[model samples]
Structures are given as structure tokens and as C-alpha cells.
Target: MTRAALVTGGNRGIGRAIAAGLVARGVKVTITARDRAEGAEAAEALGCDWALADLLESDSLRQFDGAPFDILVNNAGILPSGSLLDNPQGYFDCMAVMVDGPFRLTLALAPGMIARGYGRIVNLSSGWGAFAEGLGGPNGYGIAKAALNAQTLALSQELPGNVKINAMCPGWVRTRMGGPGANTSPEDAADTAIWLATLPADGPTGGFVRRRRRIDW
Candidate 1:
């Protein structure tokens, strides 16, 4: 069977790389972006489908209703420069994208995946989300990802069959958010996501990983 995958914020960066990698493996990939033109351009370049969906806008997610994606990558995120004291809305926005958006999408898609008896859910988490690591990042970025990580752990228990869900830290990749000084490339950062996306029935679920190795939550 041809597998179908959905990747959010896949117009560029690690999300784009992961979409391309999945396309290479013959998976039917659909990428979402806030910008329609950029999303279409990337879809054309990657030879996959595209959609306009903003993580912050809950209504925009209606487009994905009933879509039975075998793999789902919740990769869209934002990093505003401010502490909670300075900008509370920025914190909420981060939660909307990094936490709430993924939660909504997962709920929408998981039912179909359950019926199919297979699924792979990968949330683009970060080391900043790890409590043992001090949760030190931008104001809401770390908090939102930590919430996402918690969601991953909670959801894993509910999913049935061969379906698996996990969170991944892509490291400091050179992207719009990561800046030019970051060490990892988008392709390199996508490696672990791709691995988790294609895991077997016995693979680990509800875990955090980086570079294909398990890491602390």
C-alpha cells in the first residue's frame, strides 16, 4: 500500500527536508504552510501535495478533516524574542502553534490511522523541553514543546495496532528560526524524524530522540 504523510510547515527547513525524504521513499506527502505561494512552490519542487494551514488558526485545520495520513509530522513553530513578562501573547502564540496545533491535528488524523492499523506521529520537540536540561530557551518555545512532549507520552497509550508516536529534537539546524551559526543542516536534522516515521511495529513509542538515539524528556 502507498503510505500517505502530512508534514506541517514543510515549505522550508527541516520540515521540507523530511517531506522530500518521504517523497523519495514513494510516500504520498502533503505539506502545509501559512503562505500559499511558498507552499505551492515547495510542493511543485518536491513533487507532493500542499495545503494552506496556519497553526495559530484553529479553523484553518478543517482542510485536514478526514485525511488519513499514515505519518504526521508536526514541525511548524515560532520563536518570538521576549520573556513571558514582556510578551504574554507571544507565549500563547507559541503554545498555539507548537502545542495546541499538534494536539488538534493528531486528534483529527489518529482515528483514521487507527482504522488502518498503522500510524507514525512525530512531533518536532527540542532539548529545551527537557526538565532535566533546565527548560532554557525562548519564553514559550520550551514550554510549548514540553507540553507537546507530554501529549506524545499521553497519546501513545491510546493509539492501537502498529501506530507509534514519538517526539524528536532536531538540534540547532540552520533555518530561519535557528540562524546561520547553527551546526546542523536541515537534511541532517531530518534524519531522525525520517527514521521515526518509518519505524517497525516493535520500535519505541512515546520517547524523545535526537540523531536516532533516545534522549531525556
Candidate 2:
């Protein structure tokens, strides 16, 4: 059977690249974007389905209820500028999107995956989230990603069957969020995520990886 994949924030940047790559590999891909126009355009360009979802709102995710995707890419994120102390709402917003949203969606979809006996989950984490790396970056960004990584690890232990979940750092890609000077291309940044999303049953789970290599947690 053809695998189905859902990539959040896939209207552009790394998410879009990941969605495109999955479609190229014959996976039936669905992309979610906050903007209807952008989402529709990107879906048309990639020849995949699109959904309007706001990660901060739980009600918006109900649209995905019946479609239990085989692969879930939690790639939507925000890099709000300011210190965490001064920007409490920003921190909450970051956590909502990067941690809570993915957590809820995973819980919603995992049962179907378990019943089907196969699933793949990839959270687009970042090196900045690493404790060894000092959790550096825009205030809430690293903290939220760290939480996301933790969720990936914890969920992997609970999930059964061929379901494999992993967190990946796509590096600093030259996207709107990463700005124009970042070193990696969107395609290059999306590589490890694509790999994780297509892993075999024996593949490693609950690991943090970059460039197909393990990274410190």
C-alpha cells in the first residue's frame, strides 16, 4: 500500500522541501499551512493535498481525525525575538506549536498506526536544543525544540509495532526563518527528516540525528 504522509508548515521552506521529496518517493503527501492561499498554491505546485491548521489551536487539528497519516512530520515552528523572561507569551506560543500541537496530533494518530502495524514520525528539532550545545538560540525556540525531542524519545518507548519515531536537526537552512545567510539549502536540510520518515522496522528510534548521524541529546 502507498504510504500517506502529513507535513505541517509545508507551504514553504524546509517543510515544503520535505513534502516534495516525499511526493517524489510516491508517498501520498498532505501539507498543512496557516494560510489558505499559500497552502492551496503549494499543494497545487507539489500535487499533494493541503489542510489549514493553526498549531496553536487544538480545534483546528480536528480536520485530520479520520485520515490517520502513516508518516507525521512535525516541522512547524516559530523563532520569536526576545528573552524568554520578557516574552512569556512567545514562549507559550512556541511550546504550543512545537510541543503541545505535535504531542496531541501524535496521540490522535498513533492508534491507527498501531492498529495498522506501521508508522514513522519525525520531529524537526535543532542543534540549539541540545543540552551540550547550551540550548542556544532565540529564547523559546531551543526550549520548545528540546521539549519536542523529549516527546519523540518518550513516545517511541510507548508506541508498538513497526512505528519508529525520531528527532532530527535539519541544520541552519537558508529559509525565511533561518534568514538568507544560513549555510544549508532547504533540500539538504530536509534529507535527514526524509530518511527518518522512511526508516525500516529495524531502524533506531528515540534518537536525535543530523545528516544521518546521531547527535548529543
Candidate 1 minimal-lDDT segment of 10 residues: 154-163
RMSD of 2: 0.9
RMSD of each: 0.8, 0.9
Q: Which is the leading candidate under lDDT? A: 1
State the RMSD for candidate 1: 0.8
Error of 2 at 185 (Å): 0.2
Clashing pairs in 2: none
State the C-alpha lDDT per candidate. 0.94, 0.92
Off by over 4 Å in 2: none
Q: For model 1, how does the per-residue alpha-carbon lDDT over 11-72 read when each residue is reduced to its tens digit?
A: 99999999999999899999999998999999999999999999999999987877989999
* C-alpha lDDT of candidate 2 relative to the true structure: 0.92
Query: Using alpha carbons, what is the TM-score of model 1?
Result: 0.98
